[model samples]
Target: MVVGSMISQIELVLNELPESEKKVAEYILANAKEVMHMTIHDLATKAEASSAAVVRFCRSLGIDGFPALKIRLSAEVENTPHVGYFDVESNETVHSIIDKMLSNTILTFQNTASQLDAQSIEQAVSLLQQAEVIYVYGIGASFIIAEDAAQKWLRLGKNVYAISDRHLLAAAMATKSENAVFWGISYSGETREVIQLIKRAKEQGIKTISLTRPGNNKLSQLADVSLFTSRAPEAQLRSAATSSRFAQLFVLDIVFSAYASAQHDFTVEQLAKTRKMIEILYD
Candidate 1:
C-alpha cells in the first residue's frame, strides 16, 4: 500500500494503534469501498469496535469524525480507477512490463490531481511568494525532488535553497529569520531529519511548507501549508517511490508555474538571462 494513502496510513499505524482501533482499521481496509456506505454502528458491529472507537479511528486518520471519514472514503472509492499497481510477474515479457509502467505513471498523475486540495495549494504558493528566502529539505529520494524544486524556482530568480546535509541544514536553520520559509519534502512525511529541521525552523518563527502523500503525518501536521501528491501502492520493485516522485514534481511545477505567472515580466527576463549564461558556458 502507498505510505500516505488512507488505507496505507491505517496499515502503517495499525500495529501501534489501540486494540479497539486496530479492529476498526482492519475492517476498513478489508472493506474500503463498502465502508463508505456503512453507518458507524454497522461498521462497529462488523469490526467489534465500540461507536466511540470508530470515532477515534477516524480521528487517528486526521479526519473529523465518522461522517467525515465516509465523505473522504467515498471520494477515494468512487474516483479510484479499477486499474492499480500490479507487481511484475516472473515470466512477463518486456513489452508487458513497459505497458504496465506507462499505465502506472498516467494513473499516478490522475490520482494525485484528484486528491489535491485547492485551498491548501493556494496557501502554499502564497507563502512561497511572500517568503524572502525558501529553504527546501529532503533526504534520499525526496532530496532529488527538493533539488528539482530549487532549480525550478532559481531559474525564475526566486531565492531558494535545497540543503541535503543534516548538520549543515541545522546550522542554516539556526540563523534563519521569520522571513525565510522551510519546505520539507517526504512522501512518508516521517523523515526524522526533515522533522528535526522543521522544528528548529519553527522555533525561529519560520513558517513551513510540506509535500507529502495525502494523509496525516507529523511533518505535515507541523507544516503551515501542507501539499499532497498521489500515493502509489508498494511493489517488490518499489515503484511506489518512483510514481510518488512524479506526483511530487507535478505539485512542484504547479506551484512554481503559478509563482512565475505572478511575476511574468521578471521571470521572462530572468529566463532570457539564464539562457544567455548557459550559452556563454558552452563558449
Candidate 2:
C-alpha cells in the first residue's frame, strides 16, 4: 500500500477512536468494498453507529466529510493490495517468516506515513535547521533510533549528541548550546528517563520534539513538536522490536530526507566529504 492511503490511516488511528467512532471504523475495515458504494446513512446504519458518529470517524482519519472519505477509500481499495500482519505460528517455515516480516515492514511504513502530518514534519525540519545543538535521547530500543538520528545529523556537520546514560545526559544538559533542541524518542511515549530529560530541556528553555506511537501521551503533550509512528499490533514476533522499530525509523528517515532536501547543495557536499574521510581512513 502507498503512503497516506485512506485504509492505512483508519487502521493506524483505530485504537484512539471513541467507541461510537470505532464501530464505524470496524465496519468500514471489514467491508471496505461495500462501504465504498454506500452512502453515509447506509454506512452508519450497517455499522450500528449514528450518522454523526460516521462523520466523527471520518474526521478522526483526517478526512473532512463522509463523501471525501468514501472517495479516498474507493481509490485505496482499487489500488492497494489487502495486506495484513500475520503472527508466526508454531513450527512455521523459514519462507513463512520471511514473507510475514516483509508484510509487517510494508504495513509499518504505510501506517506510519498515514499518521504523519505534513505541517508537523515541516515544523520539525525547521527546528532542526535552526538549532545549534541537538540532544537526542531514548531508552531501550528507542535509544537505537536516537543514535541513528544523531549520526545522520552529525554527517551534515550538525552538533548532535545521543548519550545512552541518563546521568551522563543530565550532566551534558547543563552545558547545552544557547540555541538547542532536545528530541525524545519512545514508542510508548511514557519512558520515564525520556520524560525526565524532556522536562529538564523544557526547564532550560530548549526546544523539545517527541516521537511516539499514535494517540495522546505525556511526552507528545509536553513537546513543542510531536512526531508519531503507527501503533503496531502486538504479536510474539513483534515484541522483539520488529515492526515498531521499522515504524520509528521510517518517520525519522522522512524527517532526515526532508531536512537534507531543504539544503541540497550543502548536504551533498557534507556527505561527499564524510565519505571521502572514511575512505581515506580505511586506506
Candidate 3:
C-alpha cells in the first residue's frame, strides 16, 4: 500500500491497538515523517516505549518490520512538507520585530505554497459551489477568518453565514443537512466547541471542511476534507499566531477565487448587479 493508504490504515486502527502499542501508535500518528528518520532505538526512546514494543506496534499495523514502516513513513514525509512559524523575543527592538515578522511570514507563504495540492483545492471549490448554504465557525482569532469566508461567499451571491454565538451556531447547525457545508476554522484543530459543532454537523449529514495547522489533531480527524495551514508554535510575543492566521486567510482566499473563476460569467454578472444596486442606493 502507499503512504497515504498506510496513514488511513493507521488512523482506522489507532484506537484498537493495545495500551503499550497505543503509545507508539499515537507518537507515530503525530510524527510519522519524523519517526521515519529515527532508528528503532530512537523511536522507542522518543516514544518512551521499548524496541520490542515498537516492533509489536508495526506488527499491529500489518507491516513486515520496522524498515517497512519507516519506508512508508518516509514516503509520506517526502510527499508533505513541514511549515512552521516562530515568535519574536521579548524586549526586542522595533527593527528586530520587523525582521522576525517578515522572516516568519515569508517562510509561512513558502511552506503553504509547497504543500498545497491544486486538485484538492479544486475539489473544495466544487463542494462550495454545490452547497445550498455555507456555515463558517471559528473562535477567537479564528472567528475573524470565519467572518472573512462569509463575506467572500456572500459577494459571490452564495448563501453564507458566520455565527459568532456558540449556542446559536450549534442550534443552526442542527437544522442544516447534506445540502449545507460546515467550515470549521481552528488553528489548533482541537477547539472543543468547534469539534462539538463538527460532530453535530456529521450527525446531521452535513459535509464538513476544516482549515487548521497541520498535525494529528481532532479537527483533521473529524472533517471530511482537511486543509492545513502552516503550524505556528506559541510564543511570548504571540507573533506566531499573527503570521499563521494571515497564511490561513490567504489559503481561504485562494479557494474562494478558484471557485469564482470556475463560474466566470456568472460572477461577472453578479458583480455588475451588486455594483448597480450599490450605485442606486448611494445616488
Candidate 4:
C-alpha cells in the first residue's frame, strides 16, 4: 500500500535520484508498510543495494537517516486524509452543523502544520523578543486576530499595539525605527490597508513580520519576515473567515507562547502582576 503523503514527496524527487538509489526509493514506495518494520540493512539487501546506499536515499529526501524516515512514514499514515474544506449542506440538521464546524476547525489546524517552518518561527520569536515595540495591523476579521495577538503579548509585558484604523497604524509605523516591529495579519496577504501599513513600517526602517495564508501575496512579500497559516480553499459554506482565522490564531498563539517561554521569569512576574490588578478591580 502507498504508505502516506511521503509517497508524493518521494515521487517528486524520483527522477533526480541516482540509478542505485532509485532502486531503494522504488522499493520503499512499493513496500511502504513492510519497510516500516525493516532495518536499513534489510531494505538495502532487499533492494539489491548496500546499507550506505539506504542512508544516501534517506538523506536525499532531507531525512536524517533510515530510522527518521520510518518515523515520518508512521506519522504520515496517521495524519492522512489531510484537512480539506467541507461545505455545510443546505437545510442541515443542527447536530450535523456542529460536527461540520468542529471538523473544519480541526482540519484548519492540521493544514497549518504543513505551512509552518521551524526556521521562520524561531526568527519571528527572536525578532519579537528583541523589539521594543510591536505594531499589529489588520482589517475586518483579520483585525480580530490582531487584537487577540496584542492581548497575548501584552500579558507578557511586550508593547504590542493592535491598530484597526489605517491612518492610526500608518502614523504609528511612521514614528517607529528598526528597534520596533510591525506585524501584519492578512489571510489573503493582499489587504490594502494592512499592506500599506507594513510598507510604511519598512520605510521607517522598522522590522516587519506578517501572518498570511500559504502563497505568494503582496503583504507577505513586502514584510521582512513572512509567516504563513493554513491554506483553506474556498467552499460554499466555508468561504467566510472560518479556517484562515483559526490558522492565524494558531500561529499567533505559538509565537506568543514561544516568546513567553524564552523569558519565563519576566513573563511569569508580568502575568502575576496583571492578574492581581484585574482581580482587585473585580473585588
User: After aligning candidate 2 to the native by TM-score, how far in Å is the CA of 173 from where it should be?
Assistant: 2.2
Distance from true position, residue 193, model 1, in Å? 1.9
**lDDT tens readout by residue for model 3, 52-116:** 99998887654679998888777656775543344676687999777778867876665555445
TM-score of 2: 0.89
Model 2 alpha-carbon miss at residue 64, Å? 4.1
Report every candidate's CA lDDT.
0.80, 0.87, 0.79, 0.79
Residue range 3-49, candidate 2, lDDT tens digits: 44566667656887899999999999899999999999999999999
Candidate 3, position 170, lDDT? 76
Reference-based lDDT, residue 225, model 1: 88
Enumerate residue pairs that collide in model 1. none
In the range 1-283, model 1's lDDT, one tens digit per residue, is 1212454446545776789999999999899888988999999999998999999887666567898777766666676544556567789899998888887777777667756677887888888888888899999989998999889888877787787787887777676665888999999999999999889889889989999986678999999988877666666776677788888988888888877888889889999999999899999
Which candidate leads the pack in TM-score? Answer: 2
lDDT of 4 by residue, 31-149 (tens): 88889899888999999988988988876655668987898777765566533346788899989888878877876675566557778888999889889898988888898999998
For candidate 3, the TM-score is 0.69
Worst 10 residues of 4 by lDDT: 1-10
What's the best-to-worst order under lDDT?
A: 2, 1, 4, 3
* TM-score of candidate 4 to 2 decimals: 0.73
Which residue segments of model 3 deviate by more than 4 Å? 1-86, 279-282
Q: Which regions of candidate 2 deviate over 4 angstroms?
A: 1-17, 59-64
